[model samples]
Target: MLTTNRLRQQLAQKQTVFGLIASVPAPIMIEVIAYAGFDFVIIDMEHVMINPETVEHMIRVAEQSGITPLVRIAEINAKEILRVLDSGAMGIVIPQVEHKEQVEAVIQAAKYFPIGQRSMNSGRPGIFGRDDLADYMERANHEIMIIPMIETVQGVEQIDEILSVEGIDMILEGAADLSQSYGVPWQTEHTLVRQALDHIQQVATSRQIPYCAIPRQINQYEHWQNKGVHAFVLGDERGIAFRALQSKLAQFPVINTDRSQTEL
Candidate 1:
């Protein structure tokens, strides 16, 4: 059964929420993050190899692990959105959203009629064939989260119009991609990129909508925290694991992999 989105509640209360990206499509990893007590988990199908069945498994784990589960869909396709929602994801994070029409399409595919045009199929989240789903539409619309990524210069410029669309629960940023769009590929800290993010914050603030930042460095958190941004996405599974392992391995000397030196 679909329950109220606690993530939504916390955000409504102006509490800062933290989450890690799910780059590894494993239920165990989902449990680890949940037990570690993050506010939510993003099931990343965009850059990860997560299939529908895998998403369902991770959602099951998150349900029990005490974390809100969201999926970052590959694109803003209606069927893809419906499939994951039915699999029990509480929200969606759309990537590379640069136009108001794209935002409108996402809202339409995510919500039921009277709000938007999501198809009627109570497959799993609504308990698979519930006769009262017609009645559940209101609750469903209320609980589902709609988040769009502002990853391009065009997206930043169109923030006001995109945020104007109804049913958008939150806004997410893609620093790396935004930097790329600014002609500074992978330079998330470039002044131009940083300014663009602040612009997003400014626009979202004007509209009274919550905005989330994915920090590329540690100090970025305190900066955004002062701006009163709603949430932060720290890192993904692979990056998290790699950093931990690298830290632990730092204690031991590395076997220099310079084969040229050893060739003699």
Candidate 2:
């Protein structure tokens, strides 16, 4: 496996590693994120339409580019977790991890037997295709990271127990989902959501596990950094496109003039 320095250091220092998400699933976009200098580009499998082959290709490109590739599997199943890990994702983010049991289930799905129950395959990223199944399975389980998303109120309550799990290396706060759950809307910095996140970060800091925030909000970065948050996923593929398109459109003379005018 290519060395994942940024991710490794974040885990070690409990410092935040900023990155982006890829909802669009195009390999070419990997180049954009890599060149953009994000720590990682997660290929989303939760809501986006990405095939296994495409994910593998994206991971391969990410490996070549030195940008860590992470996969957020939609479900908590062994087959799904194995598919992504075998494709060479440096990390796996499981959604809706609200309790210790659910986190344990994700662990089993992403890790090998004894530790968990992820089926082993030396297809591309294992032993250079030499097919050393036994050793590969053993090492892969220990080396791969399992990150759980705490998005619900229930998850917030159980954050400590989930982070305390042996194989769980990191936590991600699903601000949008969490906000909606609390009936406060999907703003990341809504007071209620921010309070909830502060609590989560507190627990993470005490336990020394990395907590990756979604989207890098410049306003909140310093505060979170001071609070021991090291893993920050800056934005997603679609978000970047939308922002860039808006910025570019605003540069047009007519568009700028019209947009800047106040209605009489």
Candidate 3:
């Protein structure tokens, strides 16, 4: 499994980090994404309908196939964060973080005592009951990443303060939501939207924090990469499926139901 530190090192080296949003709940889909060569794949719990039991197996499979597994938990809930961290996620991406207090709560719950109050549990991260819980709790806080999504206008306004908060390692910009908040939905190139993004990158760069941008425009990836942005979450599972479907449909002259699965 790719540790968070390893991913951080890769980002520090200015490597173009690639990742996928695994909206599909099947554990087999996770293995496929791993073999498909993404740096990491996030098991999206915020929007995707994935149960805890199924997600655990998916994380295990992704790790087995050599891809780092990240979880975008539903919200800034500590109890939920603890469950996923204990289940052995390489890191976690939290959503809708608008204030410093919310960030603090997330950090306290995601991390263990001495740093935060993450309760001890014998799970996969502790090697399924073999490793000592106390030592594991102490060390787990240092390794697991807690990335907060900076999407709302308020979040953007408080970006600097949020970045300065301890135990937060990364920030993921929610452009669509931010745009909606700005009263210009889906307008990535809107001056206000661009300005907010610029501010985020500038502050993050100055503070030496890793910030991620989900590029909707093709050129934006290169644009941000050149601007010292390392973390890039590339595509969604639905888009990948659509592309594959289109590619397969292009080859077949007619709708051949009997042979469709075979051809695919």
Candidate 4:
């Protein structure tokens, strides 16, 4: 059901917020993430195969666990945007946004009337028609976030125009894809990628828009913190889990298995 956007409220108050990308499609994983103290979870539909039903289940778990749920769609498809928001996601994160018109179209699909032409329905976001329609529309427009990711070089070039879009609530930087776009595939910390990211951050900051950074390196958290960034998406949950499991195994010594030594 639609509710106040605590993540947006935290950003408004200049509070630092931390989140993780949920590539693992399980609602139980989302519950664990929320319980683990993440401020938000980007239920990924871009790089994963989660269906609409699973996404909604994850959102429900997030709500129950007191964490914000945002959906990261692959592109600017209206149907995808509408479905996720209707499923009760507090925000939509569109990736590879390279133009102002793209952002405009997203707003059209994500926002209600007078803001955009988002098709109306008394779905879960409207409290299943229990809440007054007009009040729900007003609250949805005010609370639901329209976040665009600036990943490509073209996106970085058009940052100003994209940010100029009235409905954009926040901007997320995509260093991994930006690195690929810069011809340094997977080199998220390459000099060129770093320069582009810094430029995006500077522009977003100058325009008074909150910039969300994904720290790929050890010192990057402090780096963005010193620059006054309030939002961060730590790497995806899968990678974090893999590393933790690897570390746990590394704590034990391997058993010797030489047959010759055992032949007494």
Indicate which candidate wins on lDDT.
Answer: 4
Better of 1 and 2 by lDDT: 1
Candidate 2 structure quality by residue, lDDT tens digits, 1-264 = 534445765568654466888998889899888987777877899999889999999998998888888899988777888788888887788888888887788788777788876765657767465766677777666667778888988899888888888877878888888998898876778898999998998898787777777655677877877765677877687977999899999898563367546776
Candidate 2 TM-score, C-alpha based: 0.89
lDDT of 1 by residue, 101-192 (tens): 99889888989989898888877778776658876777789999999999999998988888888778889999999999999999999999
Q: Model 1 residue 4 lDDT?
A: 84
Model 2 spans with C-alpha error above 4 angstroms: 1-6, 13-16, 127-132, 255-264
lDDT (tens digit, per residue) of candidate 4 on 198-248 = 988998888888999999876998889999998999999999999999999
Local lDDT at 80 for model 4: 90
User: Each model's TM-score, in the order given?
Assistant: 0.93, 0.89, 0.90, 0.97
Write the residue-wise lDDT of candidate 3 on 121-186 in tens digits: 777788766767777776677778878888889999888788889877777888888899899998
How accurate locally is residue 34 in candidate 3, as Cα lDDT from 0 to 100?
80
Winner by TM-score? 4
Candidate order by TM-score, highest to lowest?
4, 1, 3, 2
Report the poorest 10 consecutive residues by lDDT, candidate 4. 160-169
Candidates ranked by lDDT: 4, 1, 3, 2
**Relative to the unseen true structure, what is the C-alpha lDDT of residue 102 in candidate 3, on a scale of 0 to 100?**
85
